[model samples]
Target: MPELPEAETIARALAGILPGRVIRSVTVLREDVVAGSAPQFGAALRGKRFSEVGRRGKNVVLVLEDATRVVVNLGMTGRLVPGPGPGVPPASTHPAVLFHLDGGACVAYDDVRRFGRLRQLSRAEWTRWSRQLGPEPLSRSFTGRRMRGILSGSRAPVRSLLLDQRRIAGTGNIYAVEALWSARIHPRAPSNQIGDAGAVRLHRALRRVLRAAVGAGGTTLRNYRAPNGNEGLFQRRLHAYGREGRPCHRCRTPIERVVFGGRSAFFCPRCQPC
Candidate 1:
């Protein structure tokens, strides 16, 4: 699934290409990908014009002319591609939704696993959903004090806490691992045990990692791509996410890979002492 950086990259790409484009029609090839009835989804979007594009946590929002929001979650293996008008793009072998623009271009939502979603939410629904998320990690609200406040509770693995959407929205295994390594903290460290120094280090590391990932177009270890259909370059810069058994980037110890909370965690035993 695309996390904050991935979703943000796609949203920024869409912001560049989608403004002023009017939706002439919508084709829903898979009803499962539509949040509600396909007919209703089509009716809500048809003839609407895109105003802006934004991201909330891991979801992308396409703001429409009448304040309706087309929320998209690219659950693993989903890609959004734009092309010339009149037909679906050629790479849409598994197209789930197609948005036909009035100018003849089209944006295709292709998901191979059928796990992606497209939903139209009214202002109220949008507000409700947005309220459920934690502060954006890249925002000013996620300060060191704020991070420590969220971490000042019951025991949970620091990595696990970072993965909690309600605790630190948009961090997943990849950024969590990288951030922990950058902060020199262990994956299994207790969240509540982090001191002021550790918390401050972690807060800064998280912001740096997320910003760098977005700069690299987001890690594309799988089917992730920008709206322009370009693969991410961040994977080349990874330190701990998938470097298991390799030399630690900062220490000589071999990087260790373990399963924590059912997800693969990579860390250097020496650098990130536990």
Candidate 2:
């Protein structure tokens, strides 16, 4: 699954090319991808101009001229591709939706697993849906003090707490392991067990890893790709996410893997102190 940085990368890329383009028509290849009634999806979006493309957590929000927003959650194996011309081949694997733009550009949403979703909402109603997310780690509101406050009362493992969307948005299992490894913190360490200094280290580590991942175009552990269909390079730069039994970069200790919440978490036993 693409996390915050991946979603943000896609949003930024779409923002560059989507705004000012008018939607001439919309094709729904799979009905399940449309969150509401098919008539509602077509009626709300067909002739609207795209005003903006932005991201809220892992979801992409496309603002239209009529103040209607198209929200997309690109679940695992999902890809949003923008084509050069109208006759470009449709995404055959799992092409769910296609938007024909007045500018001759076409954007297709594809998800091999058919788990991604698309929904149209009025701008006024989007706030209600967005309220469930916590602060963005890269935003001004996610300060060290704020993170410390959130972790101070939690008894959950630090990695588990970081993965909670209600506490901090955009982090998933992959980045949680990477961030904890970068901070030299164990995955199973209690959140409250981390000292003030440790909290500061974690806050910085999270931001650093996320920013770096975004720069590298996000980790391509599975089917993640940029708008141009290029795989991310961050996976090559990962320290411990999927390198189980590999030697640690900083120390000679071998990285270990364990199951947490049914997901595999990789860490260096010696470097990540409990």
RMSD of each: 1.3, 1.4
164-210 in candidate 1: lDDT tens per residue?
Answer: 98887888889999999999999999999988899999999999999
Best by TM-score: 1
Model 1's alpha-carbon lDDT is 0.89
- Cα error, candidate 1, residue 180 (Å): 0.4
Question: Per-residue lDDT for 147-195 in model 2, tens only?
Answer: 8998898999998999889989899988999989999999999999898
- Output the TM-score of candidate 1: 0.96
Stretches off by above 4 angstroms in model 1 are 85-90
Q: Say which candidate scores most in lDDT.
A: 1
* lDDT of model 2 at position 146: 94
- Kindly report which residue stretches of model 2 are placed more than 4 angstroms away from their true locations once superposed: 89-92
